[model samples]
Target: MTGYTRASALGPITEFVETRGGSIERIFRRVDLPLALLDNPDLPLPLREQFKVLREAGREIGDPFFGAALGRVVSMKKLSAFGAWVSGAPTLAGAIDRSGRGLNRFLQTATVLRFQVSEAKARWSIEFLDPGKDGRFQNELLGVSYLIDGVRHYAGSGWTPTLIRSTCVGAEQAAALENVFQAPVLHDAPVSAVEFDTALLSATGPERKQPDFGAEPPIPPPVGLREEVAMLSTIALLEGSPRIDWVARKLDMSRRSLQRALDREGCSFSTVLEGLLKDRAVALLLAQKRSLTDIALHLGYSDSAHFSRAFRRWTGMPPSRYRS
Candidate 1:
């Protein structure tokens, strides 16, 4: 199942490689990949090819923990649509759930994201459907680091996994992972995963006032009421009209019941709608690819002026200045 992934998956590492004194061009050429892949993040690269580049980058840079370093620097914004979509989730567990479901949607295929809980521990893991485990050490470490980061988003940045499990063996490799994760790493494991306390799963995410980038791809069916509201609201926003009643009807609940449920979770339909708007607005502005009138209309504003006013209220500046 060597499927495909976006070239943007390399964006974070591309810069990191250069900073570490590795020539990305040489690495790509050595791996038989096109140099243009770096220029276009949305371009599709064979998943195996991406793995090869990662291994080559670590080898050339002589950084045994290169993948771990790369993972630590991965920001949600750099993930494009996938990141934006995950950021909308209300809790750490919800975000992981979204990633497990939406990874194939916004990023790649032939991969499985697994979240499991046993007793007092929770494990989150990523695995390729492909059979061989031979050249995937770096990729697995990167995946592990990414999972840790997701937990850190809510559990606080200083959070560390209770344990790290990896397919990579050897004391040296285990030591490398230990250095990066600052936790005990079990080598020669059947799967690569991070284990943490089950209690952390309930950590609430930060209020999403502004999103770094956005794209409203269809969200998978969500598990929580808050997430369901967010999903329906995104759909309504794309239809150019966001209304709570429509979402309530879709959920087979009365509008008042939905509001009370959201209140219990300390969320409201208006808040969800505003966050979605801000996400889309910032994404479009950052793209520098559309007119204010067009963006206003797309966001269901009466005109650019009204949109500008709302943008100012959300942000400190007007749309034109913000874009500039």
Candidate 2:
């Protein structure tokens, strides 16, 4: 099942569309979203539906850069406690780390936010975990925009990213994005990201009073058995290869019962583990600095050759070739 995003995360949607002379009501109806969600900030909207709303609204407004434009005006405050928590971090790097961890906890699910540091640059990326058929071009741009905005909060209003990487923008759309981001953007990339110098990571924000967020919201529930299993397997992968028996034990159930539960959901532990491994492998490869042996062991492979074999089976290419 696809995960849910808090409606507040999309608080700017209605106004953003209407200001551009688009009927958000019609677009909402077309996507089966309730108009009431605009007023109900606490409600959870399906992540898939949220992606559709943005895509359709962009088309309806005849603004190919609609998502990127809307992202420019989006306030992090709309993210509720999640926003406050991230903003309160002392350093820019801490804020980025908190945003990534808090995303699945307080704001949304079925997404991955990564902050990776290399020699002199840091890559902050956002990826939708659900690989459904919905058009995510707009959502992807919006996500990258948010990452850039977060950096600006600490780097100051005049800061521009070193580079922006995107998976969706074509030649025609690149200029519009360049104007918005004030940075060179590379399209058709592996993932959407904001790449900047490591120096900005330690930038500090002014000391100011933070708002009373009351209490943090409860962590969002797992979307389904598959997602639940996937989450556990991900953590287990760090320790080594994830075993079904270990996962079942963590869930407080027998191995056979857990297998049956997954069977009813039309998936198995092996499939879930494979998917997690593949995602991790791809992400590590994108870093472009990790060696084959390090990447292999990190993903729980016994050796580089074993991982190379698996990579060939999964992508019809070896890891070295894929990384290149």
Candidate 3:
């Protein structure tokens, strides 16, 4: 499974396409995606569909640099919750670390951001654990853009990376990206990354006004089987396909023992796994951007027929009708 991404990630490209004499509806239709999903910027769209949309949009707009062009216009305000969490951090390094750790929460099962710190520089890179069939050019471009934009929010607009490296860009595309990033972009690098001075990590930005969600309270630690299972499930999903045996091994117990523990907690292993799958399925369907076949493969189903039957049992409706 490629997991999912917020719809706002596609905002800049959508706007760019629309402004350049392209129809948003036509683009979505061409990709077999629902146009209505665009209305909710915070909704989660399957990552695979995001790639398809960008690739199709590039073809539609007749520009090979469409992704890079779109990246130039993206701002942190467009990233929603992930942006908020990044913006609220106290320091540049803290923000980068927070974004890397919490990325899976906002993007569901995807965790492609990697951060490394040394005496001289801080390197942040994106290398998908599973690249899948589609190339990662657009995703890499958008990721670099988002990192630059988010860092600028804290490090000031004048901040630039020491260097930018991307695996997908060519000499021509790299030149265009250089104009946007205002720095040298190395084409055909080992990975897509931004290298920054380590000293800047401690630099502070203007104080952000905290939201009035509520008063702060003491935080409690996660305790019990449910929390453990949930945490393990998330790890399994992000790393690859989730399996009961793998989870049991992680827990250092036999599958029977794990099931008995969950049973004592008034839940079965299948029940918990099914619940997580159902939640993920609903999010994908509400986005209305992926076919049943794609969704099935994402959920680790061997085939769509089995996935359809399970989905029907879970929701009492077909996956297609559920989206409708």
lDDT of each: 0.77, 0.78, 0.71
- Find the 10 residues in a row with the least total lDDT in model 1: 210-219
Candidate 3 structure quality by residue, lDDT tens digits, 1-324? 335566666677788899888887888877655565666555545565677788878888887656667777877644655566666778887778777776676543454788888889888887655344353676667778778776777778888888899775479977877886789899999778988888888876564534221322212223567656665575455433577786776555799999899899999877888888888888988998988888888788888898889989999999888888
TM-score for every candidate vs. truth?
0.63, 0.66, 0.63
Candidate 3, clashing residue pairs? none
The Cα error of candidate 3 at residue 268, in Å, is: 20
Ranking by TM-score: 2, 1, 3
Off by over 4 Å in 3: 169-172, 207-324
Who is ahead in TM-score, 1 or 2?
2
Candidate scoring better on lDDT of 1 and 3: 1
Error of 1 at 205 (Å): 1.5
Greater lDDT among 2 and 3 belongs to 2
lDDT for position 321 in model 1: 98
If both were scored by TM-score, which would come out higher, candidate 2 or candidate 3?
2
